[model samples]
Target: MAVPHLVQAVAETRGLGTDAARYWLELLALTAPDDRLIRELNGWTGKDIDAAATELQQRGLVIEARRRGATRTRFLPGGWMEVSGPDRPMDVWKAPHHLLWEDDRVHGMIPGCPQVVPPAELYLDVWERIRGGDEPGYTELRTTPHRRKRR
Candidate 1:
């Protein structure tokens, strides 16, 4: 399984549970460059911040990159894509809401918040960008050679 920076942080810091940590990761990924800064800015103390940063580094999500004689930690990307539903990729329209209504219910927030739902046209626009047209198709090739069975 791919390790997101915040998932490792959550596991190490012990501040937020998995779900809350995932949510915070998504939110922080939009703005923060690294998990350590995000945790620190969110009020995590010395040991917790250090542990979370160490966890992120250990998980391979955070990496030290050097440029112009300066080293910095940055998320490596890819793992940040948190798909809304099943493990397999699905059409955006077909997938469940990014967060379920039950999440709001448990957290004591308003249920079925329409403001979070983007219009159908937005989904179609994104799909068009991905599919390149209305035609339903995808490329496939068998990479492995067919092995002969031993008698």
Candidate 2:
């Protein structure tokens, strides 16, 4: 899937790469119509805040409002950002080769293949699944039925 135009536009405007833009967009979406106080935040000067607010307005992602003599910024209607990407393999983090168990059960075995496939990739997938807390295998194993079966 091709990356969405909104993602690219935001990335370009914010000077953040596509990946960081994706994260920031998703986070902004959660804020809805709430006004962002850019200047009052720590580590941000008024000039930086004004520049960011101007950029956001120019991009039509946000609108500037004046309330109680203070300028505020909020997302425009239907300005929610979305990101997409082509289906491609991504590198997965894995433990070193030496850390993996030597047992045959830990390695994936293919029928009619004498070689033992290293489980680093598989371990990465399982680790990601567990970290996400929604993997089917992990869920099943967590359920009482699976525990009973194992017992």
Candidate 3:
């Protein structure tokens, strides 16, 4: 099957309900981030959060966001920051990965980790940590040995 068709098939098999799909699509269209999106996905699908994220990554739909300037790597997704535009003064938390369906496929390697969670989930987790007065850091991408060998 073609890439597009394969993506669609995977989406269908995963069955992101109308509501969840709408929410995800809206966020992607707006280029905005929502803390509740991943939580809602978990509730809707009853799949482990990490598992859902892994599935998405395996499909080449999303990539882990790299932090701008951090020495030590941490797995906090909320720490991933991007400047929206030159005019924007404050950094906004955005989804780490772009919507792959729009571009057909992602270029370059997709980062993998032992405990991968969707950006929204990671963002929320980091947010909570910060609220609790914890420092947010970078997360090192650890690809499997086979993947590393491919590089």
lDDT winner: 1
lDDT of candidate 1 over 36-134, digit per residue (tens): 544544555545545654555565433444322112244332222222232222122222333333421212123322223443333333233324542
lDDT of 2 by residue, 1-151 (tens): 1125655765775575554443334323221212242223223465644555565556554455432222234333222112112211111111112222333222213221221224333333333433465212111235454344564
* Candidate 3 accuracy as lDDT: 0.34
Poorest stretch of ten by lDDT in candidate 2: 87-96
Clashing pairs in 1: none
Best by TM-score: 1
Model 2 score (lDDT):
0.34
Which sequence of candidate numbers ranks them by TM-score, best first? Answer: 1, 3, 2
Q: Number of clashes in model 2?
A: 1
Q: Candidate 1: lDDT over CA atoms?
A: 0.36
- What does candidate 1 score on TM? 0.28
Q: Given candidate 1, what's the lDDT at residue 8?
A: 55
Listed per candidate, the RMSD to the true structure in angstroms reads 16.2, 18.8, 16.5
Between 1 and 3, whose lDDT is larger? 1
Clash counts for all predictions: 0, 1, 3
